[model samples]
Target: MQHVRVYTDACLLFVEHKVSWDDARKSCRSFGGDLVMIKDSAKQKFILDSLIFEHWNTQNIWIGATDKAKEGDWRWIDGSQVTYGNFANGQGNNHNTRRFIFSDGSNEDCALIRRSDGGLWHDYPCAFGLGSLGYHYTYACEFTRSGYGTTIGPTNQTGSTDISNHTSSMAPITSTIETMAPSTANPNIETPAPTTAMPNVETPAPTTMANIETPAPTTLPNSETPAATMSNIIGKKRRL
Candidate 1:
């Protein structure tokens, strides 16, 4: 999600979500710039062509311009001059509407790019909530041309910066591109798979019961037989 588009002077953070103009400015301020300031048409064209939702699909971004301070006095939140505007054909008209009521009955005064139109700058009340009139807008962040050269993520899509937690230098790093569909070939280069067959292995057999042998029985001689002969001789002497 750490996507940022890099350039020589500044970087554009493409946050493709429903963000209010106020929250959008806060998000940009967290990155060191309070919303992008389109000083001229060149900057505006750069933002329109380079910094956005890839197909950017009618999803507008909130700029730093707002007339909340004084109606029709649309000025940059950083107190810069309001030199140029790329407002839509019918937008930025006499209605310099000051009173605002969000969908949830909230009030805000800010500006936004019209995604439904051609990314034209439009004066809008800053609020996106759940109600009959709730409207949410996507936003982009800008970092003033700093020599630190630090940039947001490749495209700033799904990426965020926590200013309070960071202690490192704000130097921009190399750019990052969004992940595309996995490709089998690049510049028509295809990776070949290894076709080598593995060596054959033998399986062992199962074990069973073992065989045994029995020994023959043996007998010993007796000693009482001699007494029988002495008895026979005594009987003969008696007969004599």
Candidate 2:
């Protein structure tokens, strides 16, 4: 099968195909890509005019463009609607008799194209057993931008102190369009509070027991009874 590729600078996506319309679309979606949809006269004309050869079996290759998601609402696979469509005179008026057929066969509701002569579009039957232009069954494809290039900013920051202190730098920001200056005039700008010194504590003296008072002991009664007992004993001895 022959591989066909289509792209435009205005759209970020592109489509290429070498398989049936269904397979082509599946491949596109696998990579977050879609088949090319001719939305306007300009895009249609651009696609037709850019053709270099006519290897496509049908007039147009199936594009990611379709109204299948919402019948009759015709939208590209990317959710874009048909702002423009080039239907050869009286085309697209099939009275809804056919939904998926292209021009090559019956029952094919996909799109088809001729890469050699920049042919117009028509419905074809997708189930028809007819082989492609070269009997090839696979198409490898991808999308790309025209005249557009991507730029990457520096990822490392070992050079200048300005880069290290981006918040305080005066360099104009070029990555985005909107720019703003730091609020240097605001009087309410926050300032860190000062830290307080810790207090010095002195060790206390040891306690002593000498200052404690002791209670005095009470004295017993005098021995007057013992003296009288001794006199009585002496008198008894004298009597004995």
Candidate 3:
């Protein structure tokens, strides 16, 4: 069960479950997408407007972005290059925010959008379980929307799993991805087209016939030789 919004070819579902960053991502992926990746201002604004002040301004939400791959380089779980962000000024990887900095001195690199910062983004440790300040935060999940029509579910207050999927069941999201990311680096590059396969051909074998037996010719020349010899012998006897 989940709540969602369909915008253009994309769908963003606000999952109310209280899971860790990793678990939140897993739950989003369970619906055929990863955590919502807010790629551009338009997308970010869409999320903010959709959430409104009451839902977001008072809380934080997760996005499918992280610098866990390499400290400064953020990436989307869909393997997309980071290109757009709404990071609060001085936010993102290793800025001067204590919330972003862990006392344990581990990496705090997962991304989320906060209502406190006008729904702008902030980075926290991926392991930072539930909410921003030890409170549970609702998360958004992105999905492709080709065959899946756009839909919006009822609001979930407790972030529970009471909302079931309306457009589709737990079907595979193979034809879609809607996570947002930001980078000066090229983002959303299309994968190379797959090579086409050729058809097979067959050749016929040469024809072969079984061997046949032939009858032998009789000897006709012996008749002429014997008749000639008999005439000669008769002539010789008369002469004698």
Candidate 4:
């Protein structure tokens, strides 16, 4: 299917890759857009009534609204205050601010459009069940003549799973190093100690040193000096 659909004012790119809210925003931004911001009722209706129902099959989709900057004070990615919110009843309580509700244990700081009740908006945890927790959904990117916009939703495809994979990768590298260090150091150190002791046992080094350094230095200098002196004397006698 065509990934992008153009509108009168903006263009919408429907992405099938599921990811965390942060990852979704990044994906949109990568192509010159942020998450789709339904600023007013017209934009909201266009998405819920037409775009989503027509082109998408997922139940939930992330939006650009977030209260991460300040609890209970939600804003769009452009830092504009959310003036019109079509929130579902009891969904955007903004309760306990940054604290978790032990029942669900997540701070519902980001927004999504859930299609169950005619596609009303709801706040969800930014991280939710994505990024190694193994859950994610498709998202959309909106673009204008000026720039870009973004969103995401449930149940399939790989996007941000690699975010936490570094921790898993570190485990094997650490184990391999630990295994190699001891094996190499122990054999080299222990073998050298025994070989060094064997050299001490043989003790033949003093005799070889005595022959190498002695007699040669003493006899060579004496023999060469006399021969040179005799040659000089013979040259002088011949001249005389």
Instruction: List, residue by residue over 137-209, the lDDT tens digit for candidate 4.
Output: 5666667734533222221221211121121111001101123434534444334433434334554555443
Off-target runs (Cα >4 Å) in candidate 4 are 52-55, 93-106, 128-135, 146-240
For residue 179, model 4's alpha carbon misses the true position, in angstroms, by 47
RMSD in Å for all candidates:
17.3, 17.3, 21.2, 25.9
TM-score order of candidates, top first: 3, 1, 4, 2
lDDT of 2 by residue, 1-240 (tens): 222323333322223334566666676556444566666665555445333222223434555544444434555566876566544433332323433344222233444444433455544433235433332122223344432222212211112122111221111212223468777776885888876876777768886658766667667777565555788989999999
For model 3, the run of ten residues with the poorest summed lDDT: 159-168
Cα lDDT tens digits for candidate 1, 4-82: 5544456656676666787777777766666777778766665665544245654667788877666566677778758
**Candidate scoring better on lDDT of 1 and 3:** 3
TM-score of each: 0.53, 0.39, 0.55, 0.53
The stretch of ten residues in a row with the least summed lDDT in candidate 4 is 167-176
lDDT of 1 at 107: 32
| Most accurate candidate by lDDT | 3
Model 4 earns a TM-score of 0.53
Q: What is the lDDT of residue 93 in candidate 4?
A: 44
Between candidates 1 and 4, the lDDT winner: 4
Separately for all candidates shown, the number of backbone clashes (residues 3 or more apart, or on different chains) is 14, 31, 12, 8
Error of 3 at 199 (Å): 94
What lDDT, from 0 to 1, does candidate 3 have? 0.64
lDDT of each: 0.60, 0.43, 0.64, 0.61
User: Which sequence of candidate numbers ranks them by lDDT, best first?
Assistant: 3, 4, 1, 2
